[model samples]
Target: MDVLTAIRGRRSIRSFKGDEIEPEKIEVLKDALVWAPSAGNLQSRFFYFVYNDDVKRRLVGAALGQGFILEAPLVVVGCADIRRIAVRYRERGVYLYCIEDLACSIQNMMLAAYSEGLGSVWVGAFHENEVAGILEMPENHRPLAIVPVGYPDEDPVPPERVAHKDTVKEVF
Candidate 1:
């Protein structure tokens, strides 16, 4: 599917079929992460895929009872390596670009999954400390998003969107 098609069709999949994701699709998602734009090409973002059932359950707890996490066969945890950004661009980069970099990577992964006919949801409402603890993440890596990807069992109609004219303002 094209980028626009993917963007328009993608939905937050809260329910997923038990079917396993193909390794090829997983590789494409990984490539999407690596290829995503990052500040100064420093690539502060990191990702971890969780497949174990116990780990998925722990993640659901970390996500503050978002039990949908347990339904998917895989969860891609997006993280930001703030230390790397700080080394490259100091505190300002860490504060500004690190989170954005992580977010961009997640968007790319989500779109790529959609293009591959897989389903994914971008989950950011989780407790960061709890997630880090659950994943046993390194000290410098901060978790930003937990994306559960699989064959969608539920077809969610797109949520309402505000008209573009009202949402955007011209400065120049």
Candidate 2:
């Protein structure tokens, strides 16, 4: 599918079927993430693909009982490698660039997943520290997004959006 079509058709799927994702498609998702443009090429992002049921349950708890996390066949936890970027960019890197890098990678993965006939949701309302602890993340890495992926169980309609005139600005 075209890029615009993928962007317009992709939905924040919360319900999922029990089918497992194909290994090649999972590889495509991973490739999409690593190939995303990073701040200064620091590539200060990390991910954990969780397939264990026990870990998914713990993640659900960390995500404030978003039980759909456990239902999905895969859960990808996106993290920012702060120290990697901070070595050169320092404070700004720690505060912003690392996050931007992770965000870009996550967006790439989500779009790739959609194009591969999978569904996912970007879940950010979670306990960060708890997620770090649960995943045994290193000190330099910080969890930023929790994405659950699988075949969609429900087909939701497109959500409302503000008009470009209301949100966009033209500045010369």
Candidate 3:
């Protein structure tokens, strides 16, 4: 699918089919993340690809109760190594930019999933420390989002978009 079509068609899919996702499609999503723009190209993002049923269950049980997480064969936990970014960009005010860069990487991954005919959702309302413990991430790594990817089982109607006249503004 084209970029614009993917962007418009993509939705936060919370339900997934039992079918497993192919390894090649997972690779495509990861490759897209690698190409995501990073602050100063530091590439502070790190991904923990979880496929084990037990670990995925733990993740679903603790941080997220979303059963789709367990149904999906692949769940990618996005993490940001702030210490690495801090080392490279010690200058003040750069930490926020590094975080923004991490967000960009996640967005790219989501869009790529949509383009590949897969479904995923950006899950942020979860316990970070619990997820870190489940994933066994280092102290310096911050869990940003949980993306459960698989074939869509349910279709969600598109939510209304904000009108340009009310949301956009121009200042000459």
Candidate 4:
């Protein structure tokens, strides 16, 4: 599918079927993450693909009982490696660039999942410290997003968006 079509059609899917994602499709998602443009090309991001039921349950708790997390076949925990980016850019890198890098990678993964006939939701309402502890993340890695992926069980309507005239501005 075309990029615009993918961008327009993709929805935040919360419900999912029980089917396992194909290995090839998972590889595509992985590729999408690594290939995303990074700040300073430091690639200050890491991800954990969780399939274990026990781990998913723990994540659900960390996510404030977002039960759908346990329903999806895979959960991807996106993290920003602060130490990696801070080596050169210092405080700004730690607080901003690393986050931007991780956000780009997470967006790429979501788009790739949609292109591969999978569904996912970018969940950010979780307890970050709890998630980090649950995943046994390194001190330098900070969890940012929790994405649950699988075949969609429900078709969500397109959410409304702000009109360009209202949300965008031209300074020049």
Off by over 4 Å in 1: none
TM match of model 3 to true structure: 0.93
- Which digits, one per residue and each the tens of the lDDT, describe model 4 over residues 55-152? 99999999999999999999999999999999999999999999999999999999999999999999999999999999999999999999999999
lDDT of 2 by residue, 5-111 (tens): 88999999999999999999999999999999999998999999999999999999999999999999999999999989999999999999999999999889899
Mark the regions of model 2 whose C-alpha exceeds 4 Å error after superposition. Answer: none
Cα lDDT tens digits, model 1, 17-65, are: 9999999989999999989899999999889899999999989988889
Judge candidate 4 against the unseen true structure and give its global Cα lDDT, from 0 to 1.
Answer: 0.95
- lDDT for predicted candidate 1 compared with the true structure: 0.92
Per-candidate TM vs. native?
0.97, 0.98, 0.93, 0.98
* TM-score between candidate 2 and the true structure: 0.98
Summing lDDT over every window of 10 consecutive residues in candidate 3, give the lowest-scoring window. 90-99
Model 3 C-alpha lDDT per residue in residues 28-52, reported as the tens digit of each score? 9989889999877888879999999
User: For this target, which candidate reaches the highest lDDT against the unseen true structure?
Assistant: 2
> How far in Å is the alpha carbon of 104 misplaced in model 1?
0.7
Clashes of each: 0, 0, 0, 0
Candidate 1 — worst ten consecutive residues by lDDT sum?
Answer: 87-96
Our tally of clashes for model 1 stands at: 0
Local accuracy by lDDT, each model: 0.92, 0.96, 0.85, 0.95
Query: Alpha-carbon error at 65 in model 1, in Å?
Result: 0.6
